[model samples]
Target: MSKKAYPYVLIMPSVLFLLAFFVYPFLQVFAQAFTHSEGGLTIAHFETIFYDFNFLPSLKNTLLLALVVVPAQLCLAIGMALMISKMEKGRDTVLYVWTIPLGISDLAAGIIWLGLLDQNGFINSFLFHVGIIDEAQSWLNYQNPWAIFAAIVFAEIWRATAILLVILVSGIGLIPKEYYEAAEIFGANAWVRLWKVTLPLLRPSLQTALILRTLLAFEVFAVVMILGGSNMPVLMGEAYNWAFSYRDAGAAAAYAVVILVLSLLFTLFYLRVLRVPKEAQI
Candidate 1:
């Protein structure tokens, strides 16, 4: 290959990989969303999902979950990352312990929390033993929607906050120490340093982490499935029900397309809001 053509030759494999995995699947989902069993184009699937009893609730629950969980995770991750950043000894050990949940799958984390929160599980058992409750509580029951929702939120945050932490920690590490020294020399407090120096410099990483986490939050399925089942409606859970339980491929594809659109929208929003100038980036 000519010198100028060598770069394209090197990139050919990546271009082919994206087309096969991402581009093709995306187009297929879009096609299926509009295609009917007879192979004619139709809006029946979209109409069906819109009219379904579960559609609004599922969308609301999914949005509420992300709205609640993402902010909570961001706050927790920031505090955790800041603390870890300040540590002079055993920082690696502390971070490793905190990130252990990252090694667990979503379903596995749900199951673990389930054992603790279930009626006959550790939480209720311990509470009963301590006479805090006279009977085992059904915290994960469909009757207590709040409890079930809280459980899912707890599991999700516990399992996923490590991701944000890792990203933020690396971002913090990349920030020049001279900036912090100068702030300290100016008699700035920790809070001032965080607000002025740390966060401003960390915008790019924050943008990347928030976009990635928000997208994954929208696609949350396994945790909700294992924890709340059908009692707790989420977009992904509803999509699964429509596809496998109801055997409606078209409806499932519609759900998938909606998810893709929402992910793209949030991604664009983050990019726009967090647009760091090239000169400002480290």
Candidate 2:
């Protein structure tokens, strides 16, 4: 076989795998979202989800969580990556410790946080022993939505920042050391070098990390469900309730579509904003 034909032949299995799994399932869900049970196409499923009492709150919570978590994780990851990049010793050890959370499943992480933040959990127990509170406080409850939100945000940051850090650290390693030397010779301080040399060259990695983290943020479910329950509604949680609790597949598909659209929009936004010129690429 010709070389070009051989390349396509090798990729044929992957192409078929995608068609059988991702593309096929996506098309089915999309069709289910837009079609009526009676036969004809209709927007009834969309309308049902849109008019549901929980819809607005779910959308707001999802957006707010993504807005808060993504930026916080990004900032923390960047700081950690820079620190690791500059470390003269035990870098691998530090990186291994930091990335331990990546091995943890989302539900497991949520459950772990729940054990800490529950009314009778470690935080309240510690506070009680220290005479800070007379009793175990109900932090993850409907009475205090803000506390629940905070717990979820904290859990997410703890669990996912390593993802961004690993990506950024790899990107930083690719950068030529001579660039920093030149910047230093020109009287650039560490902060100035970071801004001028590191960030500009790191745009490609930033775009990748942001887009990935943002998409996962939009689909956050297990952590929110574990930490907030019905006290704080989120898109993915609502979708699960509709699909399982309410037994409404169409509404669930509609919610999935909304999530897909949001992911696409933010992905496009990052692509546009962090567009790295070909000339600037390493």
Candidate 3:
């Protein structure tokens, strides 16, 4: 092959792989979402899900979860990354300990937290032993929506913040140390250096991390399923119910399309808001 064409040849496998796994399945879902069983194009499936009793609640929960979790995780991951970056000793050990949860599956993380947050679980036992409470409380009860919401949020943050941490650490590492030295020469403190140098340079990574975490948060299922059960209505859980419980493939596809569209919109928003200038390229 000619030199000019070799790069294309190298990427042909990846392009083909994406077309087969992503583009093909996306088109299939899009078709399924728009078609009726009788072989007619219809909006009935969209209407069905839109009118379902769980639809609005699930939508609200999903949006709320993403909004709450993404920002919190970003803040935490940034803090952790910053701390790790400043460490001269045991940095690798600390990072490895923090990221251990990243190796765990969503369902496994949910179950681990379930054992801690269950009514007669470790949390209650600990509190009882310490006399913090007189008896075990129903922490995951449906009647206590906030408690359930908090549990799911806590589990999600603990399990996923490591992803953002790794990204930010890599971004921070890319920044030249001379920037910090220059800031120090100008009487800038650690805080000023962070805001003026680190964060400005970290925009690309922040954008990528936020876009990824936001998309995953939108599609969160297993953690909510285990912690909140049907009491917590999330978009993915509703999609699962439509597909399996209600046996409505069209409705399920509609939900999947909605999720894909939302993820795309958020990706665009992040790219726009965090656009790195040509002159600012690091």
**Each candidate's lDDT (Cα)?**
0.92, 0.95, 0.95
Candidate 3 lDDT over 1-282, as tens digits, reads 699999999999999999999999999999999999898899999999999999999999999999999999999999999999989999999999999999999999999999999988999999999999999988888799999999999999999999999999999989989999999999999989989888989999999999989999999999999999999999999999999999999999999988999899999999999999989798
Model 1 lDDT tens row, 1-282: 689999999999999999999999989989999999899999999999999999998999999999999999999999999999999999999999999999998989989998898887999999999999999978777788898889899999999999999999999999989999999999999899999999999998899899989999999999898889888888998889999999999999999988889999999999999999888777
lDDT of each residue in 1-282, candidate 2, tens digit only: 888799899999999999999999999999999999887898999999999999999999999999999999988998999999999999999999999999999999999999998888999899999999999988787888898999999999999999899999999999999999999999999999999999989999999999999999999999999999899999999999999999999999999999999999999999999998888688
lDDT of 3: 0.95
Q: Where's the lowest-lDDT run of ten residues in candidate 1?
A: 137-146
Candidate 1 ranges beyond 4 A from true positions? 1-15
Clashing pairs in 1: none
Write down the worst ten-residue block by lDDT for model 3.
136-145
Candidate 2: segments with Cα more than 4 A from true spot: none
- TM-scores for all candidates: the values are 0.95, 0.97, 0.97
Winner of 1 and 3 under lDDT = 3
Estimate the TM-score for candidate 2. Answer: 0.97
What lDDT is reached at residue 185 by model 3? 100
